[model samples]
Target: MFSIFNIHRMSVTKQLSFSFLVVIFIGSLLLSLPIAHCHNAPATTYLDHLFTAVSMVCVTGLSVFPVAEVYNGFGQVISMFLMQIGGLGLVTLISISYFVLNRKMSLRDQNLLQSAITYDSANNLKSYLFTIYRVTLIIESICALLLMIDFIPRYGLSHGIFNSLFLAISAFCNAGFDNLGGSSLQHFQTNTLVNLVIAFLIISGGLGFMVWRDLYHAARHFFRSKPRRLRAFAKQLNNHTLLVLETTAVLLILGTALSWLLEASNPKTIGQLSLAKQGLVSFFQTVTMRTAGFSTINYAQAENSTNLVYIIQMMIGGSPGGTAGGMKVTVVAVLFLLLKSEVRGQTQVTYRFRTVPRKIIRQTLVVLIFFFSVLLTAYLLLLEFEPHLSPFALFFEATSALATVGVSMDITTKLSTVGRIIIMVLMFIGRVGPITVIMALLQNRRREVTYAKTDIILG
Candidate 1:
C-alpha cells in the first residue's frame, strides 16, 4: 500500500498530493520559527509547533497550546492563515486563482483539482471554483459584520475587529481555533447573538457551496412569503443537494438533543448551566462536533456517553466539496439507501424518487468502509501505545483526528512524542481523507489492459 521509489514519475493527482503535504510542512516550519523564538510561546518545542501547525493546516483544530494564552498575536495569525488555506482547500484555491489570472490548467491539473475537491469532472470546474470563492468571501464578510456587532462593545474596536474577522473565518472554515482559549466563551455561553451567529457560520460552511447554490435558488421562490404555492423555480433544487442538506439538518438537531441528554445529568458537564445556555451550548456543540472543532465546554471532562455522541457526529462530519471533513453525510445517506434497496431485494437503490447509480452506490460503500478501517486502525494503535486510556477516549481522539473535527478528550497535551506524531499523521490523512489518499496513490498507474473474468461462489 506504500512505496518510496514511486515518488518520481507520479501522476498529476499524486504530485498534487505530494505538493500539498510539502506545502503544509514547509509553511508550518517557516511559521513556527517566530513561535520558537517568541518569549510568550508556551513551553515551546519543535515537535509541538510542528504538530500544531499540521493540525491547523489540516483544519483539524486539535491543539497543544491553549491558543489564546500560548502564543502572541503573530502565532495566532499564522494559524488563522493556515486554517484559511486548509479550509478553502489548496486545490480549489490554486485552480481558481490560476484560471482567474489567465493561466492555463493542463489536463493533468484539471484532473488533480477535480479529484482533490471531489467534484465531478463533467462540471464547469473554473466557474464552480470561482463561485465557491465568491460565495465564501461574501458569506464570511457578512458573518464578520454580524459578529463585530457583538465583539466590538465587549473587546473594543481594534481587538473586536480582529476577533470578529478571525472568528468568522474560523467558523466558516470550520477550523475551530478560537482566540478566546481559556476563557472558552464560558462567560457568554448564553449570548444568543454570538452563539447563533457562530452556529450559522458553521452550518453554512459545512453545508457545501453546491447545496448553498441550490438552496439560494430555492429560497428565491419564497421572497414574496406567499406560503401556499411552491414556485416553478423551486423545482430546480437538485436531488443530491436536497438529500445532503436534509441529512445534515437531521444530524445536527438530533445530535444536539442527544448530546444535551447525555450531558444533562453530569454536573461537571452541562448540568449546572441555565436552560438558555444549555440550549445554546447544545446547538453549538452539535454543529461544531460534526466538523468545526469549537467547544463552549470542556471536552476533556465530557461524560463518556457525551464523548460517544461526539465520536458518532465526527464520523458523519461535513458534506462533500466543503471545508469540513469526515466520511460525509451524503455518503452515509447513500449507504443507508443501498441497505434499504438490498433489504427490499431491489436491483437499484432509490432516494427521493430518484434512482442512484450503481457506481455511486459502490463508491459510497467503499468510502465508508475505508473510513471505518482507518478510524479503527488508528484507535487500536493509540490503545497499544497508551493502555491506561479509556476506550471511549481513544475512540473520540481517533475519530476527531480522522474526521478533522479537532475535538479532543484533552489527551493531546499529555501524549508522548510518538503519540503526537501518530496524531499529526492522522490529522493530515483525515483532512485529505482515506479515499483521496488512496486515489492519489493509484492515479499514476494504468489499469490492466485486459483482465480475465473470474467467478467466485456466493457467500
Candidate 2:
C-alpha cells in the first residue's frame, strides 16, 4: 500500500502533474454543484463544468459559457479560488503548508519546489519560497488598491472591492479570468487607469519571481551603497534577468508596432479609437498576448494578419519561471542565438561572452518541437471536431488553449463538445508544460552503453 511518504518518492514531474490533475478534479466537482451556478442560468453539463475547471486550474481563461451570466457570486468565487491555487502552483502551496506547520522540508521537497518554480538552484529554497509568496501578495495587494481607486466609486464598496480583488489576482497570476460582464475589459478599452493598471500588473507578474529577486537585490545594493557604487550594482544583474527584460521589451515593441500597422485602418479594432487610445490598446495587446488573456479589442474582428501576429506572440510566451505559459521567451532567445551561431559557422552557442551548454540547446529544441507537435495534434483534432468554425478560428483557439493564453475569436462557446475536450487537454498539457508531461509519461532510463557517433547529411 502506498503511504504519504510514497508521494514524496514520486518524480517531481509526476507529482506536479498529479497535483494539478487533482486540483482540476476537485474544482470540477465544486463547480458542478448547483450552488455554483446561477439560479436563472441555463443548466450546465458536467463536461462544460469540467472544461471550465480545467481552464481555471490551468490558469487558462477559456470558457464555454459566459462567466458573468452563467455563474453566480459563489461560482465566481470558486473559479477565483481555483485560479489562485493554479496560478501560485500546487507545489508552492504545499511548501507553504510545510512552512506553516513548522515542518522542515526534505531535500526531495526542496527539489520538487525548485522544479515547480523552474529555479536553477535548490539552496535557500525555504527563503525563496517565502519571498515568492510575499512578492505575490504584495503585488496583488498593490494592484487591487490601484484598481479599487476606480472601482470603488463605480461598483460601490462591496462590488468594487470584489472586482478589484478579482482583477488584481487575475492580472498578477496571468490567469486572465475576468468577472467583468462577457466583454472582458472591452468597456474599459479607452480607460487610461484601467489600461495602465492591468498592463503593469500583467508585465510585473509575467516577469517571473527570479527577476523580481534580482531586481530586489539590485535595488537594495544600489540604495545602500554610495553613488559611485550604483554602476557596480547595476552590473550585478544576471544574464537571465537581463535576457528576460530585453526580450520582453523587444517583443512588446514588435507586437505593438505590428498590431498598430495591421489594425490601424480597421474600424472595428484600433481604428475606432483616438490616436492615444489606439496606442494604449496596441500596447495592451502586446503585453497581454504574452500569455495574459485580457483584451480591449474584439479579436474576432481582427485582421488575419493581426491574428497571425498574436498566434506567434502567444507561442513565444513570457519568460521561464513566470506565471505565463507557451514555449517561453528564454527558449526563443536560445533559438535565436543558436541560429546566429549556426549561420556564423560557430560550433558553440555563445551569448554575452558565455557559452550555452549543448544540453541546454538540445533541451530547448526538444521543448520547441514538443510544443509544436502537441499544438499541431490539437489543431488537427479541433478541426475534425469543429468543422463548422473557420480554420483560422480553430487554429487560433488551439494555440491559445495550448499557450494558456485565453484570447479567443468568439468561437469558444460555439465549439463542439469534442472540440472543447481537446482544448481542455491542450490547456492541461500547456500548464504542466510540454517537457514535464513528456517526462512524466516517458521513463528516464539511463543506458550504460557508449556509442560512437557518425555525421549525418543535413539539408
Candidate 3:
C-alpha cells in the first residue's frame, strides 16, 4: 500500500511519473462527464474518453474521433486547459502553485525542480518559473489576437474568440488540436498570413524553454549594455542555443525542399496547387512535422517517400525544455557531430571550439537506447495487435505516438482498444520522457574499485 509520506518521499522521477498519471486520470474523468459531449453525439466508451484525455494532456492530438464533432464547447475548454498545463509541464505548474500559496520550496523541492527541468542549477527558481509562464501567456495571447482577425468573420464573435484562443494555445504548445477540424488547417493552406503566424508559434514553442530563457537573458543584457549590437546579443547565447537554432534551421530547409520535391508531382498532394501555394504548403509540412502535427496536406495520400521524410522529422523532433517531444534536436545534433568526428579520426567530439562532455555522450546513449527500445517494443506490439495494417503504417503510427507528433495514417479510428492503450502509453512516455531523462539526471557517485579495461570485438 502507498502512504502519503511514502509518496512525498519518492524521488523526483517517481513524482513526475505519478504526477502525469494523476493528471491523465483526472482529465479522463473530467472529459467523460455528460456535459463534455454534445447531446446528439454518439455515446463513447470510457476507453475512448481516457484516450482523448491522454491525447490532450500529453499534447499529442491523436484523437480516435473528430474532437469538435463529438465534444461540446465545454469539452474544448477542458482540453485547452489540459494542453496548457501539459505544455507548461506539471513541475512548472506545481511551482506556480507553490508561488500562489506563498510557500518556500524545500531543498528537496529545489533538487527535484532541478532534476525535473534538467537545469544546471535551481537558483532563483521563482524567476525561472515565472518567466516560463509569462512567456507562454504572452505568446499565446498575441497569437490568439492575430488569429481572431481571420476567425472572427468565419466563426462569429464568441465562437471566433474561443477558436482563436484554442488554436493559438494548441499551436504554440504544438498540440495540434483544431476545432475547425475537417483536415486540420487544410482549409487555411491558402491563407498565408494565418499559416505564417501558426508557423511562428510552432517554431517558437518547438525551440524549447531553454532557448527562450537564453534569448530572454540575452535581450536583457543587450538592453543594459553600453553598446547594443545584435552580435553582442547573439554572443550571450551558449553553444546549446546556437546548436538548436542551427539544427532547426537546417532541418526546416531540407525538410521543406524534400517535401516539395517528393510531393510536387503527386496528384494526390500539393501538385495541383500554384507554385506559391505549393511552396507554402510544403514549408508547412516540414514545420508542422517538427512536433506541431498540423497537416495542410492529406498525409494518408502523401507519397511514401514524403511520409518517410515526415517520419524521420517526427522522430528527430523539437528541442529540450519545450512542450515538443522526440529523441530531440540536440540528441540528433550531438550524435551526428560525434559520428562526423569519429569518421574524421578525431579523438574528441569537438564542436564550435567546445568539446562535448563525456557525461553528455553517455546520457545521449542512454536516451537513444531507452527511446529505441520502447519504440521497437511498441512497433512489435502494434504489429501483433494490428495485423491487418501494413508494417510501415504501424511503424509510422508507433513513431508518431512515441514522439507525440500526432500525425497519423487514416487508421487511428480503426485501432483496437488495446492498440489505443498502446498508443496512450507511447504518448505518455513521449511527452513526460522520464525513462529517457531520468537515468541521465540521476546522481552517480565515483566508484572506489578500479578494474582493468577490457577489449571487445566489434563489427
Candidate 4:
C-alpha cells in the first residue's frame, strides 16, 4: 500500500503536475459550497463552479460566469486565495508550509522543489524560496497600498481595502480577475495612477523571480559601492538579465506602438479617446497582453488588425519562473536568435557574444512545436463546437486560454460546455507548461541502441 509520503518517490514533473491537479480539485470543492455564491444569484451548476475553480487555481481568469455577479465576498476571497496558490505554485506553497512547520526537508523534497521551480540546484534552494516569498510579499504590499489610495475613497473602507488587496494580488499574480463588475478596468482607462501602478505590478511579476533577484542585487551593489562609473554598474548584471530586460522593453514598446497604429482609426477602441488617453490605453493594452488579462478597451470590438497584434503578444507572454504564462519570452528570444543565426549562415546561435547551447535551441524548438500542435488541435475542436464565431475570434480565445492570459474577446461567456472544458484543459496545460506535461507523462528513458542518422531534404 502506498502512502501520501510516497509522492516524493514520483518524478519531479509528475509530482508538480499532480500537486496542481490536487489543488484545483480542492478549490473546486470549496467553491461549490453554497456560501460561495451570492444570495440573490441564480442557481449555479457544479460544472460552472468547477470551471471557475480551475480558472482561479490555474490563475487563468477565463470564467464561465461573471465573478462579480455570481460570487459573494466569501467566494471572492476564495478566488483570491486560489490565485495566490496558483501564482506562487503548489510546490512553493508546500515548501512554505514545511518551513512554517519547522520540518527539515529531505533530499527528495529538495529535488522536488528544485524541479518544481526549475531551479538549477539544491544548494541555494532555501535562499531562493525565501527570496521568492519575500519579494512577492514586499511587492504585493506596496501595490496594495498604492491601490488603496485610489480604491478607498471610491468603494469605501472595507470594500475598497478588499478590492485593493484583491486587485493587488490578482495583478501581481497575473490572474486578471476583477470584481469591479464585468467591464474590467475600462472606467479607469485614463486614470494614470491606477493604470501605471497596475502596469508596474504586472511587469514586475512577469519579469520572473530570478530577474528580480538579479536586479535587486545589482541595485544594492550600486548603492552600497556608490559606483562612480556607469560601466561598473552595468558589469554587475548578467547576460540573462540583460536579455530579458532588453526583450521585455522592446516587446512593450513595439506592442504599444503597433496597437496605437492599428486602432487609431477605429471608432470602437482608441479612436474616441483623446490622443493622450489613446496612448495610455494603448500602453495598458500592451502591458496586459503579456499575460495579464486586465483591459482598458472593449477587446471584442477591437479591429481585426489589433486582434492579430494581441494574438502575437499574448502568445509570447511573460518570462519563465514567473506568475504569467504563455510560451515565455526566453523561448521566443531563443527562436529569434536561431532564425537570425541561420539567416546569417552561421552554425551556432549567438547572442550578446555568448553562444546559446544546442540543448537550449532543441528545447525551444520542441516547446514551439508542442505549443502549435496543441493550439491547432484546440482551434479545430473549437471550430467544430462553435461554427458561429469568426475564425479570428475563436483563435484569439484559444490563444488566450492556452497562454493562460485570461483576455477573451467576449467569447468566453458564449463558449459551449465542451468549449469551456477544452479551454479549461488548455489553461491547465498552459500554466503547467507543455514541456512539463510531456515530461510528466514520459519518463526520461535512456536509449539502449545508437543508430546512424539520415538527413532529410529541407527548404
Candidate 5:
C-alpha cells in the first residue's frame, strides 16, 4: 500500500510538471508561425521563434525582435493571446474553466491550483478562481474603454480599437511588447491621457488578483451589512495581500521619485519636460519599470543612476500570482521583516498583526539566493562570449530578462545568436520560477531519526 501511494504521488507530480512545460513549449510553437513579413523577422530561424514564443507565453516581455517591426497582425494576435493566458496564469485558467464546466477538480488539480495562486487554505480555492476570472475581465474591460478614448483619435477607430485592446491586454498582463514601435512609448511621452491610462492598467494588473479580491470583500462588507460586526468577527487578513499592497505603493512612489531626481538634469532624459510632464512620465516609468514593459522615455538615454534604480525595481517585481515576474514583492517584504526581527532580537517575525512562519522566511532566502545565482551565472557566461559589451549593460540585461521586465539598452539587437539563446533560457526560468524548477528537479527523500546529536561551536 505504501509503495503504491508513493508511486501515485510521483506520477501526479510528473504529470503536472510536464503539463506546465508543454504549455510553454506549445505556446512558442504557435507564436512562431510564418505570417506577413516584417523588418525584425529575419529570413527564418526556429530559435528566434522559440525565444519569441517563450517570451510571449511566459508574459516576460523580453523580446529579441522589435515587436513593432517584426510581427504581423496574425503573429501579434497570437502573441497577445498567449500573454493573456500567461498573465492569467495557465493553472488558474485551467482550474477555473474546469469548475465552470461543472466538472470536479481532482486533488492533483487542486494542489496545482493552490501552488499557482499560493493560497493558504484549500477551502477557498473555488472562491479564489471565481474572483480571479471575474476581476480580470472586469478590470481589463474598463481599462480598454479608457484606453480607447486615447487611442481612437490618434490611430482611427479600427486601428485604435485594436491598439487599445492589445495594449490593455499587454499592460494588464505586464507584458512589455508594444506595437507602438521600437522606441517604446517615446512618441507619447508628452501625451498625458495615454500615459496615465497605461500606467493605471499596469498598476491594476501588477497588484495580484488576490489583493483585488481582498479589497473587494472588504468594500462589500463595508457597504452591505453589519460592517462593524463583520469587521470585529474577521480575523487577520491574508499576509500576502497586505504585503502586495504596501510593497507596490512603496515601489511606485519611491521609484518615481528616484527616477525624476536622477534624470532631472539630463538633456535627453526627463529634464527636457515640464514639471507636470516629468511627474507623469516618472509615474508611468515606475509602473512599467517593475515588469510592465512599457516606457515613456528612452531608457538608453536615462542616467546610469536611473537605470540602476529601474533594475532594482524590476528585480523586485509586483506580487506573486500576478502576470509580473521577479523575485516578487512579498519575498522582499518577508526578507525585510525577518531582518528587522533578527536585529531586534525577537524570536518571531510579525507583519500586519500576524506572525510569519519560519518556512516562509526560509523560502524568501532561498528565492533571493537562487535569483542571484542564476543571474550571476548567466551574466558571466554572456560576458565570455560578448567581450565588447559593458559589464553593467550585460548585468542589467540579464537581471531584466530573468525578472521578465522588458526594458532594454538597445544591446539586444547587437547580441550574438548565443547571447540571445542564453537570454531565452533566462526568460523561461524567470517565468517558470526558480523555486518551481528546483521543486521539479529535486528528489523527495525521507529523513530517518538518528540516535546521536553533535554541536559545533561558531563565532
Candidate 6:
C-alpha cells in the first residue's frame, strides 16, 4: 500500500509538500468538533473549518470567517499549534523528535532537511534546527509578555493573556491571523509599544535563520577581537546574508516612506493621523507586507497609489528559509545583479565584489517566472469570478495569497466559493513554494543526452 505520509519512500520535495497536506487534514478534523466552537458561535460549515485549517497550517492567515466569533479557547489553541508547526516546518520538528529520543539522523535525513529549508550545512543541522526552535520560543514568549502589558489592561486577564500570546506567535510566524474581531491592530495604531514590538518580530522572523546564525558568529568575532571594526565585521559575513540584510533594509525604508507620503493626504487612512503616528503606521504596514499580514489601517480605504506600493512589497516579500514567503529578497537581489551585469556587458554577475554562481542565477530566474505566472493566472481567474469587486481589490487579494502575505483589501468575506478555493490553492502553493511543488510533481528521470546548440533568434 502507498501513502502520502510515507516519508522514507517519497522524494524530499514530495515529503515537504505532502506533510503540510496531512497536517491540514488533521487540523480540519480537529476544528470540525463541536467543542471547537464558541458557546454562542455562528453556524460554521466544514468548508469554513477546512479553509481555516489550510490557512493555519500554511501560516497564510486568510480566513473565510472571523476566528474569534467561531472558535473557543480550545480551537484557538489548536490554531496556534498549527501556526508554530507550519512556521518552523516539519523537518525541524522531526529533528527535534530525534533530539528528544536520542536517535541519530541518517545522511538521507540530513539531505532531505537541507533541501526542505535550503539550509546549507549538513554537519551543524542539529544545532541549526534547535536554534530555530529556541529562537522562535524565546522571541514569541518575550513579545507575548510585552504585548500583555497593553492587552491585559484592555481585554482583562484570561482573554488578554491569550490575545497577546496569539498575536506574538502570529506576528513572529508571519501568520497574521488576529482574533480581535477583524480590525487587526487598527486600534493599536497609535500605541508605540504595540507597533514597534510587532514590527520587530516581523523583521526578526523575516530574516532567514542562516542570516541570524551569521550574525551570531559576527557578534562572537567582534567581542573576541582586540580591535573590532563594524565595517570589518560586516565584510566578514557571506555575500548571501549581507545581501538579504541589505535588501531587507532597502525595502522597509522605501516601502514606509512611499506609503506614508502617498496616504498622507488621503482622509480615509493617514490624513487624520498625526505626522508621527502616520510614520509609525506606515512602518507597521510596510513590515506587515513582508508577509506578516497584521494591519494597522484599513487597506481598502488607502489610495490606489499606496496600494500599488503595497503590491510591490507583497510580491518581493521577506528573506528565504524564514517564516515569511514570496520570491525572497535574495532572489530579487540576484535577479537585479544579473540584470546589471548583463547590461554592463560583463562576463561575471557580481554583488559586493563577490560573484554569484550560474546555478543560483538560473534558480532565481525560475522562481521569479513561476511566482509571477501563478499570481497573474490567479488574478485573471479571480477577476472572472468576482466581477462585483474592484479590480484592484482582487489583484491585492490574489497577490496577498500568492505571496502568503495575509494583507487583504477588506474583501475576504465577499469572495465567492470558487474564489475562496482559488485563494486556498494559491496559499498552499505559495507556502510550499513554486520550485518545491514543481520538483515534487516531476518524475525522477536522468537525461544525459547532449546535442549541438544553435542560435534561434536575435532581438
Q: What TM value does model 5 have?
A: 0.88
Q: Tell me which of candidates 1 and 4 scores higher on TM-score.
A: 4
The stretch of ten residues in a row with the least summed lDDT in candidate 1 is 437-446
TM-score to true structure, per model: 0.88, 0.93, 0.95, 0.93, 0.88, 0.93
Residue-wise C-alpha lDDT for candidate 6, range 355-420, written one tens digit per residue: 888767866777888998999999999999999999999999999988888888888889988999
lDDT of 3 at 184: 86
Pairs that collide in candidate 4 are none
Error of 1 at 280 (Å): 2.1
Clashes of 3: 0
Which number leads on TM-score?
A: 3
Candidate 4: how large is its RMSD? 2.4
- Clashes by residue pair, model 5: none
Write candidate 3's Cα lDDT for 337-426 as tens digits: 999999999999988989998877877888888899999999999999999987888888889888988888878888998899999999
Model 3 Cα shift for residue 451 (angstroms): 2.2
| Each prediction's whole-model lDDT (CA) | 0.77, 0.85, 0.84, 0.84, 0.76, 0.84
lDDT of 2 by residue, 47-154 (tens): 999998998888888888778777888988998888878887744656745676576666755664565466667467777877888898999998899999999999
Of 1 and 4, which scores higher on lDDT?
Answer: 4
Candidate 6 runs further than 4 Å off: 93-109, 435-453, 456-459
Candidate 2 residues lying further than 4 Å off, grouped into runs, are 1-6, 90-116, 228-230, 435-453
C-alpha RMSD (angstroms) for model 3: 2.0
Give the lDDT of residue 429 in candidate 1. Answer: 80
Cα lDDT over the full model 4: 0.84
